[model samples]
Target chain A: MASAGSMAAAPFWRAAGMTYITYSNICASLVRSCLKEPYRAESASREKVHFSVSKWAGGKPEKPNFVPE
Target chain B: MAMAALRKEGRRLVLSSNPSSFARSAVFSEESCPFGARSVSTQIVRNRMSSVKNIQKITKAMKMVAASKLRSVQTRTENSRGLWQPFTALLGDAPGVDVKKNVIIAVSSDKGLCGGINSTTVKVSKTLFKLTSGPEKETKYVVLGEKGKVQFLRDSKKSMELSVTELQKNPLNYTQVSVLADDILKNVEYDALRIVYNKFHSVVQFIPTISTILSPEVVERESESGGRLGDLDSYEIEGAETKAEVLQNLTEFQFSCMMFNAVLENACSELGARMSAMDNASRNAGDMLDRLTLTYNRTRQAAITTELSEIISGAAALSH
Candidate 1:
């Protein structure tokens, strides 16, 4: 019952909707992956494991005994 | 009136006589033909480059996504390997019984373009059907994916239970499998339960693994592939629960977990297969584009040379 004009437009509308849906799904998954760690910790009440913070040795003496005047 | 009519006819005749020459003069005139060809070809090359770059960007993003999924799935598969071994071993230790009624849950991907992952599972299922048929034997099917459901319904002579979950979209959750498992447990009665799914071996290769869940005797028997499942330990009596309750829970839990694991493994296989397929497609597209550009260039060059010869001839004709 649709006219030719509307029929031609239908495919474009459908394609636009599909792309939007796909993008939204991908975005939602990315967001979920991002917040997964925090969500897991809060739900389980599990203790957080910490990693050792290492410091590098001081490079060279600021004054190398031959100081610039 | 005759002179006016003659002049009009003369003009029409002059126009008709030099149609090609007029077109040639307009298009390939004093304006350098090489310049036109060079500019047009450059624009085309630039356009193609941008499109190819866009494709590369998209493919790179997909590759990264596939890698992340592959990592998580591999970890889950390794962990479940330990779980399936003990559960299957326990079943093996159960009393042997004649399995006349068989229900095989053959899992395949809903989506296509996942290489041979689905086909391998189908092949194994077909083999299972051929091997298990006899005069009085009854075999049923519980198909997990759309593809498998359709295929079995068309070709399979036995009754099949199809489970389709709404949550089969991107980032699949455990609910899909749980729904399927519940439906399967409720409707069908089969002495032997076997599941055919792709077991992830590597990125390129996933072996079709068919594991028998019911008829504990089959579980006890080592697989033809000679993969030995370690011996099962006796159930330790926990504080409050009776052995009967525990065993019942364990059985349900094991089945649900196994189904869930199979679906996840299938998803991983599907993605991996698609990723590889797309990778090849993108590469082929690049190759095609290269060939097209070369052809386009050659066509443009030949056009320019023809134009140059025409202009020279036209100038010579004008001088004469």
Candidate 2:
């Protein structure tokens, strides 16, 4: 009794072997994209995932660099 | 001469009293009494006044922070509602059902100072636990957030199966929440999953809400049993060999959507509660400040009157 049974044979994302996490993330991003200006920008920024990256040289370890999304 | 010596002793005592120590501050009643160490304790009262002022400042700042965050969080909560409401509309939400395996996911906030948001969920969850617990029935607690976890651990530690804390440190979105939902799904199996969270009503009000997501088999049974899923007759299933497969995927996705909305709404309610809590705290601080200032002034007046009387008595003694 779930919604969208009449539409496509499958939900398409599931047919493509996407996990529920990926499917839901795509749906959420699509929703986020439809928001008005400032809010859209704010949500976009909040969703960004930043990481700290470091590369070791031949001898000592190199300085860590912050990788921005 | 004896009176003069007593005056010197009082001066030495006042000087020896720690001016910035609130722990030694005299109560307002003790300060008003015409007796022991009245002047000595006024300095401690001054210390208490400053500590209260600092508390007022912190609470005021927290209120402002919560106010600012509330707007964005509220917007997101409203948007995420669209994700789960459709699922409820189609599948029909589960009512009070006695199930063999029940998983109760109680959403709570990590930070304190929010009025009864955490306690409300804990209380509701506790009630649910009591109701669903019996000889054949079992209830497992899946508490989300540190606040609820600490309280749940106290008495209901044995019933708790899983706890996901510190989720509040990151921004809440469907992406983040889905991963958590997936993690929960992987770890716990249930016939009926009941999510407990605070439903934001207004600035000063919120309700502890529990929404149920039944398994596909339970859904079919409920639908057959004249539940609200009578609309199931209208829809057709394809691509999947059986209705069970489609319902399975839909149920998992719906769970994620529901959890996402739950986290967002709980966050919004927490902020609203915090704003009001901090506002009340700041107002209480202002009242305390007024009373302390009044006592301090009275203590000052008493010291001045005593000094004047001492001078007059000494002058009279000299004349005699």
Candidate 3:
């Protein structure tokens, strides 16, 4: 009842305070980033964000942008 | 003299076509054409029509773009659904969670012109807000995407806790969504999160969906009231208090997975909606363009016929 991938990843990623989706996506993107030029650009474009967000607390505006990760 | 000649020619044609209603037809024509310069009106219609055609061209292009991107987004959404369904199956989806403190996370897009996807999410969130608030029960809103935030600020300003936007301006990935989920988790601590978003069924169909995730303590209490956690007893745990911590971790992870899945679904639906909306706009523009062109042609022909008749009458006058 134990697969190596599941046994190793499920606990580590869950312990990192992240979900399986995050783990899979980060790994997938990490692999994509390691690829050659055109492919790397193609993969990076899929995850890029182009806008800023503002936070409001009880009708009072706060930070214009939260430093993007 | 020319006036009499033109009247006589018109009467002769109307008499030949419909002998009985000739007088009424002449009177109707007199009443209808009170203004001259029909060519000027036709020119205005022609200009407006060309503008409509330009708009149709742009909408057609937009429709093609949406259609092209839809396949990839749809595939992403389908794959992402797997991430949350397993979690939902494990941790019970408490549909109507009536907790003291609940936060409604409404998902939408940053841009507009994609039909009513955003409004529908907001509507569901607002309706849920109304249902979940009372004397002791506290209900707040955490709006995801800027469109929802603008609507929330319009009237439901006081209830909004956090608003995130610009997530859809570029390509979407799970990492960005997880970051957003973490940001929300850090700021807002509530008994449950009622996540509302649009679910993409197909290109032309998307329905509003709401799923509730309870906090660790609530889930523990829920296990006592009812074993809605169908197969929860099979899993082994070390201690009693540790169960809450496990559930806590599970709840947080579940939130991240759910948010990632929801964002992908919302993006897919947005593109699908844009496709249909732009298509409809293009079709309507084509119809209007056809009608306007027909009107313009008829006016141009009428002017030509009148000029020919005047020439004929003047030639007749010169010969006499």
Candidate 4:
């Protein structure tokens, strides 16, 4: 019976609201899937400044030399 | 069902016994061939049915996967509204840009498994083409999706060149849009421009939308916003001398960001469409499998019942 009701109403639902509803749902799902928080990381170079969104890559830093006067 | 199968065979065997002795021998040869052939055909049919049932299992699994993907994407889409709404509102009816020509950059998906998502965007592109392709100025088309490429294949023959089937490699990032924007802007001969895309509305809906990045039509579309653009024109530039340079830079920046946003929006929509389409397909497969299984069981039971009844009758006749 439920299936019969659905069979009768499917065309109407498709015509009236389902079209927009489906389109909107698809868009909403796409947006929700892509957006994300920025990852955390330390700056790699002396010229670089750390932003909240960045993640640090691990590498050895150069040793500093003391100047003799 | 088993009883029915035995009965059908028993009836056939009983019918075979009614012939004369010589006829019975001939009947055994002729009748046995049909019975064996029928059995073989039924077996082949059963094999086909099982293969279809296996396909249904695969489809059912895909449906579950799509459902999970749908859930995650739905949540992400909901949060994106906060990010985009402010930027779009501030964009405020493309400040009156007067140009002899105009172009609309349309983004669509390369892959199609999504239901009507691609079709809706293509339909909008067609409308835009009709709207702009007047005697006043030539209308140019730039399509970002393969679906668009196919849609406009015939239309490309008309006036201005139509770009179709061009797409960036995946894990689609902002850089791809920048490159696409550069390609578009380089070829653009238009004074005014606009972008038409799908705006994410919900898990099941997307609004076919046109947003003006630059247009003189804003006066026609946004009668109220025209007054605001006039007010902001005075304060928009930094110094008198640098006004042109600053305006150019700002306009380019906004254009790039807007274009990038459109591409991202398109990508999300494509995924959603595919997921939904797959979901529906899988559900249909499951329903078909259920029906086939019912038929298979009935057929198998009927065959079994006929064989059982024939054996019982043979035993009674020997005892008599």
TM-score against truth, every candidate:
0.59, 0.77, 0.79, 0.62
Model 4, runs deviating above 4 Å: A1-69, B1-40, B57-91, B94-100, B154-168, B215-226, B240-244
B19, model 3: CA deviation in Å?
Answer: 36
**Interface DockQ of candidate 1:** 0.01
lDDT of each: 0.55, 0.75, 0.75, 0.52
Q: Which portions of model 2 miss their true places by more than 4 Å?
A: A1-19, A22-69, B1-25, B28-41
Best by DockQ: 3
Better of 1 and 4 by TM-score: 4
Q: What is the C-alpha RMSD of each candidate to the true structure, in Å?
A: 24.4, 11.0, 11.1, 20.1
Q: What is the TM-score of chain A alone in each candidate?
A: 0.28, 0.55, 0.54, 0.27
Clashes of each: 0, 0, 0, 41
Q: Say which docking band candidate 2 falls in.
A: incorrect
Model 2 has a DockQ score of: 0.09
Give fnat, all candidates. 0.00, 0.11, 0.44, 0.00
The most accurate candidate by TM-score is 3
**Cα miss at B141, model 1 (Å)?**
1.3
For model 2, state the Cα shift of residue B57 in Å: 0.7
Which lDDT value does model 1 have at B108? Answer: 83
Residue B268 of model 3 has an lDDT of 93
**Ten-residue stretch with the least lDDT total in model 2 chain B:** B5-14
Query: The CA-based lDDT of model 3 is what?
Result: 0.75
lDDT, residue B17, model 1: 53
